[model samples]
Target: MVNGEFYRRYLNLPDPYGQQETSFTMLFEFREFEGKMYLKYQREEDTYNLFNKTTNAIILKQSFMKELFVNNVLPHQTHAPDATMNMNRSVEGQAKPYNEAFWKYYNAPVETARDSQILKALSEMESKP
Candidate 1:
């Protein structure tokens, strides 16, 4: 099991130091596509500083466990892309619109939790009604 502390360190979040302990919650949506698992997620948490209140971020990750370990295809390489420039140009044009929409919809506020002093201050703020 991956703990909150692992994420804090991985994301380079600041330690709570002598102040209150920091807390984090992650929500993920898992999907299986073409025999691979994709995890789309968002994380929300209090800052290390008391005054900053809450912070959040989104992430996407793909897992190829079956292909790598079960199928033993890690050492094999797939066929190369077509050498046709027209094919590539058309695909790139089609992809741009899709990429733009995807990012705009999924975009959210993101910040590092590595500032201990700032987090400590945010933690001490009054709760909302």
Candidate 2:
């Protein structure tokens, strides 16, 4: 939801390409006030300038996962308990902190669950075009 993390993660994942180096790189950027996220694909040098931006801006709370998966922008995963939780947390703004103040409220298991969820999601999505 924030900065199209799901989309970017799916694209950059090391697979399907058969160890082939990517011709382009991707990143996510959040625009909180707009309640939307941007998925940016930056290509190599001037040659890349010829391409147009395939920007996807969507509501922060919306699930762009299905659409992304269909468009090959996201990998499909049926067992992403962690990712599901993380996504829910992110939507609710109850996520474990990544900053210094995180430990004050979060426990190890919570973090582990979140990580596991993300990993499972990624693994399921490893199959790509």
Candidate 3:
């Protein structure tokens, strides 16, 4: 939840003074290999903040889930002569023509409801005379 007010109301708690809500998060995973630590990935989440609610029974209206398992280790290279670099890339912004091999091998996340809406809108726009 962006604003803590919703949760506070649900939990029957008073609002905190000057509490600014954040809609950003980052997750990281690391592994140790050859007595050295290497980061798997540091990713920023893309969020759609629209919520459709109902007052009845529980229903699976929307969901996003991902399960990952890494058994084989990747090539760990270092930019520095002595430093070890695990992974390198921009966390956000436009996709660049970099790491073609890695990007080719990478599988994108499953399309969400928001993604479907966007695609449909684009298709409709393109169909306009």
**Highest lDDT, which number?**
3
- In model 3, the runs with Cα more than 4 Å from the true position are 1-3, 6-22, 46-129
Expressed as tens digits, the lDDT of each residue in 7-51 for candidate 1 is 332333354222232444445555565577654333333433222
Off by over 4 Å in 2: 1-18, 34-83, 87-129
Q: What is the C-alpha RMSD of each candidate to the true structure, in Å?
A: 22.4, 22.8, 15.5
Give the distance in Å from residue 52's predicted Cα in candidate 3 to where it truly belongs: 22
Model 2 compared with the native: what TM-score? 0.15
Q: Is candidate 1 or candidate 2 better by lDDT?
A: 1
TM-score of each: 0.23, 0.15, 0.29
lDDT to native, each model: 0.40, 0.36, 0.48
Model 2 lDDT tens row, 1-129: 246532222223232221211133333433332343434222221111121124332212211211111112333445545644443333326544578776676655555788999988898899654
Q: Write the per-residue lDDT of candidate 3 for residues 1-129, one digit (tens) a residue.
A: 535542211112232212212234557788888887776555554322222233323222222333233456655644444333222433223244689788875887889999999999999999999
Pick out the ten consecutive residues of candidate 1 with the lowest summed lDDT. 62-71
Please say which candidate is ahead in lDDT: 2 or 3.
3
Clash pairs (backbone) in predicted model 2: 82-117, 83-117
Q: What's the distance in Å from true for residue 123, model 2?
A: 54
Instruction: State residue 108's C-alpha deviation in candidate 1, in Å.
Output: 16
TM-score of model number 1:
0.23
